[model samples]
Target: MRIGYFLSCEEYAPDQLIEQARLAQDAGFHGLWISDHFHPWNDAQGQSPFVWSIIGALSQAVRIPVTTAVTCPILRIHPAVIAQAAATSAVLHDGRFVLGVGTGEALNEHITGARWPFAEERLDMLEEAVDVMRQLWEGDFVTHHGRHYTVEQARIYTRPPAAPKVYVSAFGPRSVQVAARIGDGYISTQPDADLVKQFRQFGGGDKPAQGAFKGCYAATEDEGVRVAHRLWGTSGVPGELAQVLPSPRHFEQAAQLVTPEMTRESLPCGPDPAPYAEQLKTYADAGFDEVYVANIGPRYAEFIDMFRREFL
Candidate 1:
């Protein structure tokens, strides 16, 4: 499987993200995945720069392909607007851009004060949203009047020769089927073979299915665990809470139930290549075409260097 680096928008500032993109390219990583977030999950993460502006900077910073590790076209931003932004990004990156999208979480989408829809409702909205985006990308005047959105006379003026590929992120079987039916590719954070197989069986065929995981690198295993638990104990937040929690405080409250051991058990940590090796193998065995690993703390330079020496 191709190994890439993931840029955590929730953790690093804009300049830092650009620097990491450059460093990742220098490390011989194949591509890049960037998170899009309105808030940092928790305040300790301490940053959430405008992702579009960062993407523009990244085009100058690195030659590696860039993908939004899932943007939500459903709520906070209208699909028409997202389509234009994505088209411009594709042009900026010389068509080395993929627009990875999902139904999104209340944590980011709730800020517009629109009522959070149930899972079934969100899935319905996502399908319509993608349809709208595809219409806008065609470069013709678009007038869409769908159930969840409406766009009139919208045309993307600055588009690449090809529309950016849309990769759908899905965790459940129903969502997987929807992704397979409408998505150009697939995205996931888990190494679940069942979900990958379902996407292929349901209609996705041999399109790319990218997977990712978070990791922490520090001076020692214990320090890595503490840093991870301190910064991203939210990773241990179970089930739909990640989708339902409306704010950082709610995540902070849910995180009390999570512990350092939970973080350690959940992700690869510390300096050893053994755990990182296992992570790569698991994603490969899970049938991922590409896998991206994200650093949870501040030691990203070391993480990329370690990958260059061992993983690359």
Candidate 2:
């Protein structure tokens, strides 16, 4: 399985992201995964730069492929605009860009005061959004008036020779089925073998399925746990809270129930690269074609170095 580095926009500035991309490329990471978010999960996690701007900078920073670990086109941004942005991005990256999309979280998409829809409605909207984007990417004027969205006389002029692949990020069965039908690839954070099988069985066929996990590289496991808990405790937020929470304050409140032990158990933490490698092995066993890793705190450089020396 291919290993890539996930640049967490929720925790890094644009320059830091570029630097990490450079580090990951130098360390032989196969590709890059940069998140697209309007806000950090909580204040402790800190930063969320405009992802499209960062992607533009990344085109100049590295040669390996880059994907938006996941972008929500159903809300926050219109599918028409996202189509143009993605097209420009693909052109900038010389066709090495992939647009990984999902039904977004309220924490980011609620800024426009749109009521957060239920997961089923959101998935339906995602399907329509993907349809709209594919039409625009055909390089002709498009006018779409669907149940959830409307676009009039829209066309993407600046585009790569081929449209950027749309990889769907889905967590549930219905969403997975929609992803299999529409996505050129699959995206998930878990290494669930059954879900991977369902995706292929549903319609994904031989398309790539990507998996990811988070880890922290610290001098000690305890320190790693502390950092992970402080910065990304929300990673432990259970169920639909992550999908429904509307603000960082709400996420912070939910994160209070998460303990350091929970955080440590959920992700690879500490100085050893072995746990990280083992997690990758698990994804491989689960049938992932590619897997990415995100360093949960400030120790990303060390984590990337160890990966190069020990795992790459």
Residue 152 of model 1 has an lDDT of: 84
For candidate 2, write residues 1-312 as lDDT tens digits: 999999999999999899999999999999999999999999987899999999999999999999998999998999999999999999999999999999989999999988899999999999999999999999888988899999999878899999999999988899899999999999999899999999999999999999999898999999999998999999889999999999999999999999888988887888887788789889999999999998977878999999999888
Which ranges of candidate 2 are over 4 A from the true structure?
Answer: none
Off by over 4 Å in 1: none
Local distance difference test, candidate 1: 0.93
Worst lDDT window (10 residues) for model 1? Answer: 259-268
User: What are the lDDT figures for the candidates, one per model?
Assistant: 0.93, 0.93
Model 1 quality (TM-score)? 0.99
Number of backbone-clashing residue pairs for each candidate, in the order shown? 0, 0
Write out the backbone clash pairs for model 1: none
lDDT tens per residue, model 1, 1-312 = 999999999999998898889989999999999999999899899899989999999988888899998899999999999999999999999999999999999999999899999999999999999999988888899998888899988888999999899999999999999999999999999999999999999999999999999889998999999999999999789999999999988999999999888888888889998899999999999999999999878899999999999989
